[model samples]
Target chain A: MAKNGNDKSRHIIQFIWTLITNAYLIGFIRGKIYQGKIKNICVPGLNCYSCPGAAASCPIGALQAVIGSYEYKFSFYIAGFFIIIGTLMGRFVCGYLCPFGLFQDILNKIPLKIKINTFRFDRALRYLKYIVLIVFVVIMPLLITDIIGQGFPWFCKIICPAGTLEGGLPLVILNDSLKSAVGLLYGWKCFILILLIVFSVIIYRPFCKYVCPLGAIYSLFNPISVFKYQIDKDKCVECKKCASVCKMGCNPTVNPNSLECIRCGKCKSVCPKDAIECVSFNKRKTN
Target chain B: MKNNKSRIITVSMLLIGVLFLSAGILRGENIIIFEKAINICLECIGIG
Candidate 1:
């Protein structure tokens, strides 16, 4: 009961944060900032840096900036920050903090008439994120150098609907000059955004499930991440109820820390025997 | 019984931790290194 209450409270808080970070609010705040050093808060999860309303710096953008900086070295500060957050909370950030994740959650609530069962295909395609993490997020930027031999934001340009919807749209709208300069790349991004918006209405979080390199990176820590779920085999009867309720279709009993498991706690809430519990690495070590 | 449970949990955590650490290290080495960061920065700033 207490766990469920905590989950509900966390969900509410996440929803409120999403509202505050929406394009309207961020744009308003950014409009107020004329000059001085604006302290940009780095929230975990993908938010767009180019969004006219964004008050905080997108971590991905900052990381890319560091990568693409004139200096020929990676910024330890940004990398360390992401590592610390990922190791500590894993995808809990995705479930409890990401504004984009919250947007998907809201879209998921729209009383949709059509639903597709792509569990098998989805399971296979989940590996695609690791490829994306390597190719788009990590490799492409590093390997592709220009005349002066500097990296580019390949992932941001090619993919990332958050960048398109939150960053690209607002900037183009607010600055009429940018509208006139719109090209094939802008159209491509808009197309991707539309596809994602429509897909989100049908699927839970197609991006999070298949495309989010950030999610892929965080998922690497899912097993050993401080915030984790455990299943007591002694109490479990192999009822498969947990699996049935899992939106990610992950079997908690087989692998409680499956990369696909978002640590949403839905399975834990539904378990009859209270076999599942959210455990901390520190707590386990001390015991 | 308690010892057995503890051992299982410890072993599980160790294996998982090693897997994650290895992957992180591999990714850091193979993909995200200093040279790459420099390249990305240059491209974004349009000097590339």
Candidate 2:
């Protein structure tokens, strides 16, 4: 199938945004991280704070840090960032802004063994991200504290393939000291990252579909986000073209605002009758 | 009526976000983010 122009544009935007957000070139060269005022601001996607070129904090990482900190139990800044961004675009951030999403997109483009459009237990597995959000991102950071009452970023330490791929590998590769310090945890994370990379080649966005806590958080706002999918029932012919084209397994005609829908516009692009449109919540009635 | 309700909800959420953000800034939470982000996160890099 020919690539849609809009899809092409989205890929460009994703690439450009990834570069813009991770624009600290000096850090990559010197094997050091960017320590600047911009670091105080959290990025909208899953870019790692430990990424040498990253100039902004990751929302998940910052959230975990604040929740884990003995001195501070909650962070209004992080909460507010999530609310504002989620309400504005929901998983649109996953579609267009996330660096790891871009990575998966690129990896999926590689011609590999037969692609599995949907795997066994796909329906049930989608709920795993929510579990990860509650347990790893929220509970672990809040409940499990050290002797000094400091909590650890359990998700980052334990399950975040983005952290492993973006922060762990690059820093370890660049720093000899880090290479020597690598242990079982690093190996475990690397194994998880490799598994995800392999799965992403076959199943599109396996992490976002089943593992990303951030995606789970943003998805809660999909039904109410200002920007959302709207189908023209009048123009629709009940063709399942949109569903077939949807990598996220959403039926745009039936439930355009499914939490699984990333607002990636693949469904819109492939709709033959021009029935699909991404409309704001306020303008929904007019359409 | 539904549209009005949605608009109200959206506006309310935005206001709440603004309020939370203002409170966070007032409490110097951004400084904490800055401090944490400035350092090398050993756990994040799998070195912790």
Candidate 3:
């Protein structure tokens, strides 16, 4: 009963954080993107830069811009930002802070008969996000250039369902000028967004599992992050309860700091022995 | 010993992050990020 309460609290926290991050009320009302100094700082989640209500920039978008720009090949600021955040909490950002992750969590709550938690090639498909981080977010931007030596943010342009949903839809719907400009590309992105929405209802965070470049980057630091999970094997009875409750499909009994763990705390809540705990920076109990 | 190593890694990574962030700020990378973010990129909205 206490664990279930914690789960409810997690959702409430997710919703509250989402509201705090995208809190430019004037922008939402006027269909304009916030151009404040706050926008200079990139939020840890996958919120879009062009979102009418977004008061902060998306880190992935900022990373691509720096890598793709003619004047700057790379930005130390952005790199440092990722390192600091990734090393501190890792994919806990995905679990608690991401708007898109919240969207998926909400969708997965709907009662569905055919919930596809995992299927064949599920583990293999997890690598696709890293490939996207490399190819679309990193390599393509540096390699391909326009006449003026400017490069495109390929992921934002061709992919990034978050951009399409959070930024594209609102702006286009509110502004008639943007409506006429919308063409086949917009249609394609909308289709992808729709497909993802449907999939989210059936599957648990399919995008985070298979396509989110930000999730990919953070997942790399799950093992070494200052905030991490610790499982006490002495207390554990080797029951598979923790594994079964994990929506991200991580087995905390075998590996407490699995790369796939979003630090959602489901395993911690469900552990019968009270063995799993989220601890900070090498604070393991002596037992 | 494992705990000690983890502490070292965390501190080292944090110092490195601070170093890089300082360097980027000195290079005016924040200005570039600000400029890019203030304007709505056509591509970001899935158009143009």
Best by lDDT: 2
**Candidate 3 lDDT over residue span A1-287, tens digit each:** 76688779989999998898899977877988999999778899999989988889899998888878888888798889988999999999999999999999999999989999799999999999999999999999888999877789999999999999899999998888999899999999999999999999999999999999999999988999999988787889999988998889999988998989998888888778999988898675676
Best by TM-score: 3
Looking at candidate 1 chain A, the ten consecutive residues that score lowest on lDDT are A31-40
Per-residue lDDT of model 1, residues A44-95, tens digit only: 7786645555445566666665565445335454555566677678888788
Writing each residue's lDDT as its tens digit, candidate 1 over B2-35 gives: 5456446545655554564455444453233333
| Superposed model 3: Cα runs more than 4 Å off | A284-287
- List model 2 lDDT by residue over A1-287, tens digit each: 43478788999999999999999978887888999899989999999999999989999999998888887888898999999999999999999999999999999999987898887899999999999999999899999999999999999999998888888998999999999999999999999999999999999999999999999999999998999888788899999989988999989888999999888888888888888887877564454
Superposed on the true interface residues, model 3 gives a C-alpha RMSD in angstroms of 1.0
Give candidate 1 misplaced runs (Cα > 4 Å).
A1-10, A19-26, A29-41, A282-287, B1-48
Per-candidate iRMSD: 8.7, 1.1, 1.0
Superposition error at A239 for model 3 (Å): 0.8
lDDT of 2 at A162: 87
Report, to 2 decimal places, the DockQ of model 1. 0.08
